[model samples]
Target: MTSPLNTLPALEKTLQEVEILLAEAEGFDEDRKKLVVLNKAAFLLLVGKFEAYIENLVEEFVFAINSLELRAAHVPERLLAEHSVQIVKNVKDHLNNGKLEKVNSMFIDLSRYWAEIEPCNSLNISNKFSYGKHGEKELIKMFKRCGIESIFDEIVLYDPQEKYDSNEDSVLDIKGIFNSITNMRNNILHQDETPTLTVGNVKYYKNILVQLAECLEELLQKIISNADSKRQKEGMFDYVI
Candidate 1:
């Protein structure tokens, strides 16, 4: 069956292909020295792709929340007020008459304003939420600021105390995992590091990525489902002519 996480199928397939390629590379004797070098390059490429997928997932989640909140409340003043004084004033100016056309125009202006001030879109997720940065605290702050913190906390799976291994008793530090992944990606891209990767390392990283993706998928599904139920309970349609 397809995974509940929509992105998992593609990612899993790619990872499996990488594993096969690595295994084949290992079969070559030392006489074929380039095989090992090629395997390393492939490993780095896999890491790069994994990092990009994570960032894209984060962007999608933030955008979905922002869109839902905007729709549930059509008044741009309330949404943009906290972000920027000028934008609030502009929204007020366009919406002064309160005509349908005026409201529509104000919405257009507000969209531009929101695009400019969106926290996640304006900054890299790592820079915005990494340990030294806001970390989990910043994530909560942003969600609360957007008025979705309650639902976010309810749905997001961020257990800092989770264990990665039962036999070795290795605890999974969520913050450290995020920071380490971000650092590795940055080091590879900026420092041109050819980091060695064994099969064991690939398996471990794959597990981490899978868990992260599943959490994000679950969060997104729950948020949307809850929003739809609320609208239904209130006897509201998605849009009105």
Candidate 2:
């Protein structure tokens, strides 16, 4: 598809995939293998959605730049192809380097691609996020607080002493939760063996995934709202970890 025509439809497709997977995940029974399958599927869908957002941004930028009376070198097409060859290259490099979050890598590419045209659009200098090592003391605290302490045999946190007090009103443990999930996922990933998922483990993982989704949704809402508010702020036109 042409760059301009491809942008919105691709994003819509990704968003649709996210919605479908999230809904399907909601109805998943407490089956270990099924949950694992669903979890991986949902993760892939999310990453695809994020990549689509990055691609759409690149495509839209190209369209906008092409309309302006700028030099050919100034157009995104000169540097970024319609098929996103540069982006795919970076993602490949990141995957080869053992970088886990391809979505963040794609976001970095988006920011860099945008900065070349509009520096103001390069909001975040880096897009990397770390939940730290699993089985750390803080993760233990998180599982304990979340009422699922025994599911994990080990905890590996980056900072053991980091304080993580969940608000009585909130069910999310943003810092520790992701770390715990990543740890479990790594065990299954790195071992080259099938994961032994007990009934308890399945339940715990399902709960963690749900909480993670809610936390992310809430955070995204807050960021979007803040951007809207700032766009209307004193003499400002418009504008995350």
Candidate 3:
């Protein structure tokens, strides 16, 4: 297991294993069922791992922010403001459930929660997402929940010199990569068809995920900066010791 702080390495480790398995499967070409296994099982596992990587990293990031014990006042203004919308959603959800509600008490409750709120966590980010598409838009939206706006847009501006794939100089089509991977994975899971996947196909998807993880690892540093910058470093000076 890789440290939660270093998501890229953890992601790479799993992908490397998957690649090795695919490579080994080639040696047993006499067994046709091995191809089916790779098509269904290994492919599904690959998608699951990528989704887990995204969710786990995001969850760990929120936990890291909260574990610092920073008060709401010490948090980034944009992040706090975004989370306040979640509070509103929480209040609205119970009221509009085809039942009449009291306006005055709800107002008081909202004010109270706002006044007593701590740093927002994963729950705040997960609200109202009925289906987990895990597509490019959804993933970018997840990062927005943490105040990192337009993440893929930032990825587009990646320096060619610091490429995720050193052997390739072409720009990364982040959206296309995600769209392809999710489309294939969703087709396999949501449908009954035994999708045609090859050792090369598995390797292809694995490599794409590896590249994406590199992008995420580099961009996610902004989260640490957000946490550190918003910390109330001089608060102890105001103590009455």
Candidate 4:
């Protein structure tokens, strides 16, 4: 499948051009113009990337939900529709009958699972060799491409501002998590002498990756569930009735 993110090379190129233009500007007036260009470039990047992120998540949801439906059995095709309808109607009842809080809270907790893996600000692993030199960007890219981006979308949707209940367990802040991941990638690229694979460092990165994978899987599952529910609610049930 073609990644939505693949279509943004042109925008990225525009950003690069703007950056170059900003750098070449001289004098206070030109500097102000550069700032505007910089802001516009930033907005364009965020909008393009974030929209792709959501679209990718929706794609994953559709795949998972359809797979599950195909695997389930019913006496007749109409029976399948009826069952799906009941499930969605029940879900809506629960949502209106004081269960929305619990549902939202459950999603929030699932998102928090990613926090179990503490991301290191810098991998102090093996000071002699940089992880980037070892092709760590490939690893990071694999992580996101594999599903981290979708997971990130769920995390954001669950906690748009990172807010939570007063007693809620602290999870990895989305910004912090994203920054740490990016930092690790950068460190690898720059061949920074990070902490070598000491006990703490090894466990940290391993846990981080593991938590990321688990979180992503859970988010994908929830997205699938939501999609299934939406389909059932949208008059797919009428066929059975």
Evaluated with TM-score, which candidate comes out highest? 3
- Lowest summed lDDT across 10 adjacent residues in model 3 is found at 232-241
**How high a TM-score does candidate 4 get?**
0.31
- lDDT by residue (71-160, candidate 4, tens digit) is 222112232333334345556667888898765754443233223222111111111223323233333333343233333445532232
Candidates' C-alpha lDDT:
0.50, 0.42, 0.63, 0.38
Summed over model 1, clashes come to 0
Candidate 1 lDDT by residue in tens digits, 27-107: 665635566465655556666566556555555544554444434232123223544444445567666666658667546
Which whole-number lDDT from 0 to 100 does residue 7 have in model 2? 41
The segments of candidate 4 whose C-alpha lies over 4 angstroms from its true place after superposition are 1-62, 65-170, 233-241
Ranking by lDDT: 3, 1, 2, 4
Candidate 2 Cα outliers beyond 4 Å, as residue runs: 1-177, 193-195, 235-241
* Regions of candidate 3 where Cα sits further than 4 Å from its true position: 1-4, 13-24, 69-74, 92-124, 127-132, 156-169, 194-196, 230-241
Ten contiguous residues with the weakest lDDT in model 4 = 118-127
Tell me the lDDT of candidate 4: 0.38
- Residue 231 lDDT, candidate 2, scale 0-100: 37
Residues 79-158, model 2: lDDT tens digits? 33432444565677787888868858676656655444322332211111224433335433432221223323422222
Task: Sort the predicted structures by TM-score, highest score first.
Answer: 3, 1, 2, 4
Error of 2 at 39 (Å): 10
TM-score of each: 0.54, 0.33, 0.69, 0.31
List runs of model 1 lying over 4 Å from the truth: 1-5, 28-36, 55-170, 237-241
Question: Which scores greater on TM-score, model 2 or model 3?
Answer: 3
